[model samples]
Target chain A: MKDFEALKSIWHDQVALPKVSHEDVLKNLRKTRNGLASKLLIEMIGMGIAAAVLIYVWIASPFTMWTTHLAMIIFICCCIYYILAMISNYRRINYDKLLDKPECYINHLKKYKHDRYIFNTRKYKVYSIFFTAGFILYFIEISFMTSLWITVMGISFTFLWIALCYFVLMRIYIKREEAKLEEMIQNLERLHKQFEDTDQ
Target chain B: MSKEAQFKEIFQANSKKIYHLCYGYTGDDETANDLMQETFMKVWQNLDKFRNQALISTWIYRIAVNTCLSYLRVEKRQAKDELTDTIIETRGEEISEKNEQVSTLYKCIAQLEENERIIITMVLDELPYAEIAEISGISEGNLRVKIHRIKQKLTELYNRHERF
Candidate 1:
């Protein structure tokens, strides 16, 4: 039987060549840091641009109906809410407290995962409801101005699109996000259990 | 020294052991390399904030253990048996006899519990037992017991792989 010492000798006898150079690591560090920050930055910028355009439309358009103005306000609020949520999420995941003990880090990850699940499911539901309500209110004014067939077509198409999003797209997106979060949670929990086992 | 220079020194000192630790956990060279790089990236990011209360190596090890534990790519992680097969088939000719033995050793190490794998790799690297305990967040006495058990498990696995 090979003793532990023998195994240690074997382990030491093996040579490890560094596959990644220091420069490569530096390059990757810069790239990854910039990549995550830029992605979030782009998202926030997109939301800002969208909100700005909507405000401009609200100001420039000659809509006499109060419903249209309310719709525009609702749309702008959704954009602002989305931007704030994205910023919060970006801050949540980009934390620098990675030097915490394993159990603490695991707990941190579990909390983050829990928060993400709530945000993805419950928060998304709220956003969708508000968005659909805004669209419905907006459609009331359009229906008054347009022909009956046109209004019917427009309403049907909008509701169909909303139904598709609420039923199909949102479900798929939530399922994918949940799967990813669930896997991370499971891994963290296992590690947490391992730590507890050691403590015991 | 500049931050980059300081980081280079730290990386040069710890990267190899970190790679071995990751390799022991993953049993795959490419994955181990990726993990080592990732560990260093975190180290570089947080280097300025590092206080001197603990050894730099210990801090890096904590980051590495956390990184390995939190890695969620379940699909890319190969089972021990599959890893052994892939090693034999792909690098069979390219690897030397000693390298083959080392690979088998890593395969055996991969068979242990996740925490056990990390602990034993540190042990093999001859890290001070106190430092290992600190990095693993366990009492040194408990760590010794865990190491003894892991060594037995790893030896049994290594012998079994040898026979096969």
Candidate 2:
């Protein structure tokens, strides 16, 4: 390691040249450029669809039941919170200064995990309840105004949506996020331990 | 020059050096190649915004550094420890004194703080202090101090890991 100059000389000698031709870069750039716009468009379209449904439910809900009105209000509030939190997390991760230390990244990841836990466990539980309640109330009004078939169909749809989201969060997403952080932390910790070992 | 031409020239000039930057951060060929491509894609996209206020090389280096950091955060959580393994296997193909030297340096570098690793690699690549400071987003005075400390740590580790 004291061969610092020798190390530097060796580093300069190595080259990882691109196998792709300039023509390939130009072609890939065009494809990649299209990917950016399409991704933005898709996100906009998806958000538009979600916002349209939520806003419609809030505004055009023709329910005389106090329970129905209350449920809709709760659901709307939940939507607002979800959107705000998503934006907050994105900005928090992106806008923060790139801290140099691996420990700093580990610490940042810890905070991220903490926030995700709250979102998954606490906030999600509350959201599921409010969403289910909202649909149930809305369906009850449907039962009164229309046929039982329509109300049953609405309830079935609501339960299916809730179940899908629940399955995804519990089985797929949370585990994946946790495993990623834990694995990264393990590697980072080992690197730190190497230094400690060297000192000893 | 056309924007495409300008970008090609920039890519031609700095892509290998930037790949080394990515290599230092990732310490693996596959991930380093992925990161290098990502960095240049970003460079091509953001090229028009390069207002000539800073040196093009510094701007590009900053992009590479940030891209590498972000890539580490998202892509492969198991990177650093695997870095030592990568150096041995990747260098085996070349098998020379230079490869031996780089392999050892990379192992020592893996122990430094993530930012410290990037800074020292750039220093070892012999980028000027001003350019390093600009890319590292530190003042030159602070960079000198930081580099001095990192060098001492590297020397200690090298001596300890030295093959008898």
Give fnat for candidates 1, 2 and onward, in order.
0.70, 0.22
For residues B1-164, could you state the per-residue lDDT of candidate 1 as single tens digits? 89999999989889989988987888776778899999999888888888793599999999999888877775756647555433332334555776778778887887888898999999999999999988888899988888888888988888888888
- True-structure lDDT of candidate 2: 0.69
Q: Identify the runs in model 2 with alpha carbons over 4 angstroms from their true place.
A: A18-33, A36-40, A43-130, A146-157, A167-171, A181-200, B73-95, B152-164
For model 2, how does the per-residue alpha-carbon lDDT over A90-154 read when each residue is reduced to its tens digit? 45633223323333444565566677778877788888888887777767667888888877887
Q: Considering summed lDDT, which 10 consecutive residues are worst modelled in model 1 chain A?
A: A89-98
Write candidate 1's Cα lDDT for A8-63 as tens digits. 99898777655888889999989988999899889888889999999998899788
Best model number under DockQ: 1
Top-lDDT candidate index: 1
**CA lDDT of each prediction against the hidden true structure:** 0.84, 0.69
What DockQ does predicted model 2 obtain? 0.24
Q: Which pairs clash inside model 1?
A: none
